[model samples]
Target chain A: MTMTATTDRTLPDPADRRAAAHAFIAGQARWRWPEAVFWLVAAASLVIFPHSLVLAAQVLIAGLFALSLDLILGLGGIVSLGHAAFFGLGAYTAGLLAAHGWNEPLTGLVAAGLVAGLVGFATSFIVVRLKGIALLMVTMGVALLLHEVAQKAHAITGGDDGLQGISMAPILGLFSFDLYGRTAFIYTLAVVFACFLVARRLYNSPFGLALKGMRENGRRVPAIGGSIRRHSALIYTIAAVMAGIAGGLLAQTTEFVSVEVLGFQRSAEVLIMLVLGGAGLLYGGFVGAAVFLVARQILSGIDQTYWFFWLGLMLVLVVLFARNGLLGGAKALLARWRRA
Target chain B: MLLSLANILFNGVAYGMLLFLIAVGLSVTMGLMGFANLAHGAFAMLGGYVTATLMAKAGWPFFATLPAAFVLVALASLVLERALYRRLYRAGELDQVLLTIGVVFMAVAGATFVWGPSQAPIRVPAYLTGTVAIGPFDWGVYRLFLIAMGALVTLALIVGLERTRFGAMIRAAVDNPRMATGLGINVDRVFSITFMLGSGLAGLGGALGVNLIGLDPSFPIKYLVYFLIVVAVGGLGSIKGSLIAAIVLGVCDVAGKYYLPDTGAFIIYVIMVSLLLWRPLGLFGRR
Candidate 1:
């Protein structure tokens, strides 16, 4: 009687699946208005203000960079100050490959991602062992060591003079990279969209949920029989691949690479961009990159040196007041305004 | 071969002494307060820049500007601690790292705005400029001066930290802050003082280091990782560990550059990794 009762409950799954799908669709429909409006505004801004496209491209790259950071940092609770290691590695790889007679842009880009992923995988073993500030210092040390090697290796990397001559054959050989950066912008935007979709999928996956649990309480995760090291290492590797792709895009578009690609500044800037965008939130990175790149461009144009003071004040203010970055704060403020 | 070895030894000791001066504070801060301050190097840069500008441009004497460098960096550290760092002490390490990063950005920008992007040569006095010979060894008097000054400071600091009441409190706090606080030691005051003291040393290092290393806007960043490694390798929270590690790192780096230029940085990492493998925590650091 008990076996028959259990079988009867288990066998009625096809109708149940349809009902669950309907509920999910209904829930999504409820949130679609706000999501649509946000994207519509983002799209309109890119069209109305053509210059915003350049900013958008930067935001796209920055988002990818920050997304990589968030996977390890926000999800796995690993604080890395040297994420630029992977980004720069990818960039240098792409640039080097393109410079040395590899005409296929996509192939070079994929190579860049693969190389960065390998480095990330190797480094994750070292990184996962350390915790807190010690982890940060060691990771940063790795990046600095790499940076030093890059700087001192004059023959291969072109030293401080920078590696300049990278020629990427047209994307799929049909679309030429134009002078106005239109093709580059669209290409980056497409890449960013694809990455975002994948990141979204991952975040909703079981592994991602397990990582979230680990971040909340590492000890608790172990009690539940989860291997925190393996999860953290895997996420770190994935993030590296994302950062590498971002770097590849950068290398391809800029057609130049330098030792500066791996400098502390690059690392620091990515961190800032991440914080400036709301970390853990999917789109916060893009918002942050846009705000920061635009602010930087405008401020530097006015007076290059004074821009730091502004950035410093902004960072302090953001930390103290906004805390959630520009978009997060703006959303809250708008909500309050509407309520008022 | 002997002369080259000696030369390497001399250069290593000198460089290590400078690293020690900068790193000692990082060790203290990281060990004592658990604060990961990336901007400490910025304080050093500030000291170098201030000393350079005052000594070179404002025509201040070495003796006069040396104290001024200490005072300025100390004040800056105190202000930073009070204004920003206090809020960050309880925040996660990532926040602290990022906040300091912001400060570094500001400092770099400010330095660039004020001094342009050129490397400013900070000249020592004529009396301290030339070399001094000891038997077969010829050493720059200024380098020797730096070593002597560093040793003196290290001695004084060791005595202060080990012998004084403040030292006892600091030790107690480092060992068990809760017990120290329960015993009526002002932990907050200790944290501020420790930060100031550490940063003061960094300033001193910067000012003194400029004679050898020169001053640049990116100077802080170049030494930031090195200083952190010293603090980390020496074991967090112990002044003696920092001192020993700094000197060891300094000598090793100098020797490596001379003996194995291709693998100098690798050697330093090897040492650090090996040390960690042996001690896990650090040389003098307790788990």
Candidate 2:
């Protein structure tokens, strides 16, 4: 880490600049190793833990969902408890296309992303100016509007029964989504890895740095020539696309879409999952979605009625003790142990 | 068509009054404490539930049960403040949002467990049941009662918040807690009192609102967003603002249901979004 930091400032202008470059490089190095390890482990798990492929696939989708949330909540300083607006919109778009005989999964996914992104762009104009609870409330109003439309309009959306008939033909007309869950799992995993790559690149980019600064001090960001509204709008749109892609993935795998996708609970669940894993940390989304989904699964299997109670308890605990989430908490403990 | 308009206005006023009752507390909590009380609607639900159970199941009279409902809901909120909300007082926006959301979830789930998923039907006394005919118009007596109650509360609250020492102290605390603390005001005590008062109003709204919307397990969750929108539009922590905004939203929403049936619910959201665009600080809210 020290060597990388020194080399990062081989052509620095000042001492502080040199130190910042070194720190940046060291942070990059730290991120790279774990990223590589996660990919390797992810590949190995596919081969070794094939029975859990379905669970892993769902985690990948949900992780992407959580990542979309982290972009706004973690980086952009926008706390939205109703992110499912884009997620559900994308799902419905994909589902509608598939039900209408669109067989190409990639095409459906892209279309879903575009449609949700467009909606996000339209709504972001209204949402960008407001801060704190007002922003949260506006986003929720948008989601609720979409939900009401979906529920009441039976002809198009099939209402509460949901648009059911959906079928993805194959990937590149090659791999079939067989009953064994292999094709579906691999497909989702690949999408998640691609999204992860893009997200990481974006985080380390100038845009991402500016967002971090904006979160820390909004006034300072603009003083340095950054348009806060533009940055917020841009990041919100990107997050919406990511959320849309996650929604498309859900449609491809589950082949079912419901109005509940746009509900406040869906948004709240994502927020909980994102916070639980750790926000701002890139891989925190994955950790949070995995732990939260698994816990919910196990608890539901034991008794479906008490799942909310347990989930609520976990949320409260995460807020009180694990402020940075599970990974951050674990990292802190590790650092303490090493110091000892 | 005339009847439909009348019906819309009637429903709108009734709906707005209940909304004001439920949301006034939320606005105060949000404005004063800077905490989002997502569980505010749940208190309203609890009030309805308690009132319904007492009247329908436990054989209690309407007059006695009404006050009892406020006391019960207020007590629950006080307990909540002491144990959970107080700890969350200084937390970040996300923490408050998530924690309050957790409270909302638990409240809904707990209510479900206790009351079951079935809708509970509640009614007012026979004396307050029939409609009052005005010219060619006949309106539900209960709805008129709700309107009267809202107007009375508005008048009382306006006088209380703007004129009284307690109101001045509360306002001072809201504007600047540190300054109020420095001035030797008991901020904590003030916070507790405000929370209880807000929660009691929500409870009252819930009890009165039961006749119109009935009691359902998901009512809190469904109406949570609606209440928030009203609070946002009215400006945070302004009782008069909440009253005006609630009535406007209630009227527009109900009218839309009759006039633009196809886009009924969406109309309200559209209006909210437009209003937000026009005045991000809300109609009466100051920066």
Candidate 3:
């Protein structure tokens, strides 16, 4: 009996080892100093710029969109060019809901998430099977189709006049959406923060590690007893939900939804934002959205027609020189500083 | 009803030929060279603009401007390949996409700056203006010209690729670049020439298609999807596949527009998605 017990102790169960590793990784990811500092700085920005609440709200929505993209592209290694499908779906759902008198914010957001998640779930089966350029084409096709549908469905979508007269109610029977966007900013921030926490939890989970493994080497996933299709579909659905929430937030704050919400340009712009911030890192979305949105606002003010020229040039330079994006560049610099 | 069907078939074939002309070069670059060039539509736009400018401003005949468009676009592509695209041969698909997208934006913006934000109108020669009566069907003379041009180019391409020494060299280089290099074939030069050839064809297509598709600052963005669809559905690197796919797409698009006027451009995408789902590697694409 003692010999058998010794042998069992010698060869620990694989499941136990996995659990221990997961716990260790989860511990490591819990409330890092950098994350704390990042959130602190973000909070401080709201305090410092009291008047720029609308812009702040817009940035938060953009950041949320970027984050949703990051979950699929960065972590799951699914490069989608049509993520605006979910965002638009969410926006339209919330916009329609408000326009038709279901003006509650939280319920509308949840409905948006569910609608987008349903769409994502339905599409993921077909989409997850594709890789590389084929995947890109399919995603693009979906977005283009949605855009055309939205454009042509004039009776319901308002046909380029945009879905208007969407009046959202106060947050939790208080904090009405003021013209100054004070309530909008705080509500957006809170939603983003809540979504960020969920994403963070997912990132440190066993499923996230599995996704990481697949990203590194897709072939090895099955050998280790993981289903790429199942995992991809799950992540895609979750990402869609997150994107839906972002879109709903935008609609609620702005009280409008345009066909532009479903445009290919929006998809491309979100991709550019994610790439600019640095993919693979959780905070990269926030950083990228802030920089891209702010830069666009400034550049458009300077020369509305010629702003894309500068934006295009920046994208080219970034892809050529800074493949890892702004955050990656910063990380590299910090590492160098520490080494020195 | 029969006459409308005939007209649709004829128009579809003409449009398909135009798409083939634009997409063939893109397929060669994407499939043969392994480069994801989203700026290819820009080259086609350049060709159209060149043709339009010469015809409208210089009083050049429409037919005479086609070759000029081809040559100019070819030369431009050659210069760009040497200066920029050559360096990105080994870059990831994401980088390639971003770089090409940037080029597209720049091209669009530059075109807008140079030629004001208006569609460039084309004046077809008088002989090519009217329709021809054939067994109770009216076929546009300009469309006949396009069909003829497409056939000639397809014939030349097939003969050149299959029955010539230069064609063998290209095939060899594409199949095994390392082996071709070992055999002392200047693979780089072969690629450059091929790239130029592809760009030239796109230019020719653009020059020919300007009247049919319209030309404007947003030309690249507008037609990029169509070209990409042709290349993708044709099963990249296959000329015959592109030809077949383009024809099918053209027919479907015309039919969809005629039947379902409400959906506008949605049907083609639906077709693309369904087809892609059925065959992920494209209809004729290799595993």
Candidate 4:
């Protein structure tokens, strides 16, 4: 045992291991064929599904929101039930800006992201310190607080009446939000694509790898010179920004913002979307959002009244048997097939 | 001024008692069992509906339905714990949360369909109608009755959990299930019983709260934050902590509503977040 241990001490030199890690990171950072196909299909849907642009735009928004949630949940191992706090903030930010004459779509998104990130940073002190259910409650509390505030602030939010009569200028002073839903779909798709690109790049970076280590064993990460608070705060803020932009997209695309944008149901819906897609994987949010929205559309079309029951049943079925969600199930099947 | 203040205090304490009644079970389920049962408020909603149905449709007195609600909801919870919740005890935290959330959704949908999404009204019995003299001032008999019931329940829980052999088994099981199992304790049975008790109390609390808080389809979602606040602030598994936290939050809620209606509801959420920040494990949590 002693001789074997001594031999291991000098094996697989540190430099070689470092080089291997870089190669692995580079390989992961490179876009895979599946991602290329996914985006291509998404962009192509603009023409393929000409009549479904509105729903398509909505899917993109939910996808972006779910993607933001995925960052903290799948990557940082932070679980929350109130991620709508940032989304709501973003929506309101863009809505209020449009209401107050700053209707430039892209800039509105930036402002939404900044506001959401600031709120996230402010809350990070509390968020970073918690784990499991406690974290869920705190995050929920923040969202509920925001929801309550939104409901009560009648002058600013228009209370239950919602923020109405707000309009945004055309994208880049050229493409106006048309009645045919083309501009909104393209705008949302472009924004979602941009955010996804940044998120995808970050997912395989050295910092992202360190985050995975933190998620696996937080105590060990601290021992290895990682500041858990700093990493969590940064990722949490980035996710919040992404969520905010999604919210901003909704406000800009729809030309309205309602108090329900900040509701607990919205938060829960996005969580379901993320879970349905599968967490951690970058494409999981997009896939989950697509399935959830399309399923919701079909269900609501059939029975508008009892749709919540169907949703509940779906979530229950998902949690019970498909804990890792559809993508995970497919991957598991793939692994078994390979083994066979 | 003194009398109104006294009235607010009385109402606030009564509210706090009701909150404690609902949240104490969650304190155990989440704090002791380490399961995030977000649907806890659903059990409370079920209790409220049972009471409403018994009093309104079945011509039962308001007081008579409380026990029925407790018994019925306890039975329902037993079925749920056995078939659904039991499967996820050893599962991931998120799965447990999602499952319970799913349960909440189903319960909400069921209630909405059965009860038509309207508030279920329970008649305030003649016995609890008017104010009675206490010291120099008259206080509402209903509020006084709520306080008395809350105190009785608290005492019973403390004695039952601390003085009984079953309670010892529960503590052992919660602290270390492996060791408790090794020592011949039936951990599963203990957990089921504990869950039943927790859910039963929730039902009773819900039944009792109908007059003050009202019973509705949205009850579970609406008061979820408050129940969670009580459990989190009080510290998981600490009955004493929950009672204190409930009373503190109840008073704050009541006072805030009365004093500053515009921002009163926001205060509790802020307080919960701030307290959790200071005591992440909770004010009295051991873990």
Relative to the true structure, how large is the alpha-carbon lDDT of every model? 0.82, 0.86, 0.90, 0.90
Q: Output the lDDT of residue A34, model 2.
A: 67
Question: Tens digits of per-residue lDDT for model 1 on B43-66?
Answer: 999888889889878899987898
lDDT of 1: 0.82
Per prediction, the TM-score for chain B is 0.95, 0.96, 0.98, 0.97
Native-contact recovery for every candidate? 0.42, 0.51, 0.66, 0.70
lDDT of 4 by residue, A283-333 (tens): 888889999899889988987546778778888899988878888888899
Best candidate, lDDT:
4
Write candidate 1's Cα lDDT for A237-307 as tens digits: 99999999999888888788898888878888887887888777666777778788889999989987788
Predicted candidate 3 versus true structure: per-residue lDDT over A1-340, tens digit per residue: 9998998898788998888897899785779688889877777667888887788789889999999999999999888889999999999999999999999999999999999999999999988999867888999999899999999988888868999789988889887998888888889988999999999888888889899999999999999999999999999999999999999999999999999998888998898888988998988888889998899889989876587787788788888788888999999999999999
For model 2, residues A1-340, the per-residue Cα lDDT tens digits are 9997898778556888868866885586455566788778877777988888888888889999999999988899898766999999899989999999996999999998999999989878777888776777778878888888888888888877878788888899999788867898889888888888888878877778899999999889999999999999998999999899999999888888888888777888888889999999988889999998889889989866478777878887888788999989988998999999
DockQ of each: 0.44, 0.63, 0.75, 0.72
Cα lDDT for residue B193, candidate 3: 92
Badly placed stretches (over 4 Å) of model 2 are A1-23, A26-33, A47-49
Which residue pairs show collisions in model 1?
B31-B237
Model 2, residue pairs in steric clash: none
Task: Work out the iRMS of candidate 2.
Answer: 1.5
**Rank order by TM-score, top first?**
4, 3, 2, 1
Which one is best on DockQ?
A: 3
For model 4, which pairs clash?
none
The digit string of per-residue lDDT tens for model 2 on B1-287 reads: 88878888998988898899888988888888888888889999999998999998899987788788899999999999999889988888889888877777777778778998788877788978988889888988888888998988888888999999999999999888899999999999999999998998899888888888787877778888779888889988878788989999888878887788887688888788778778776778865
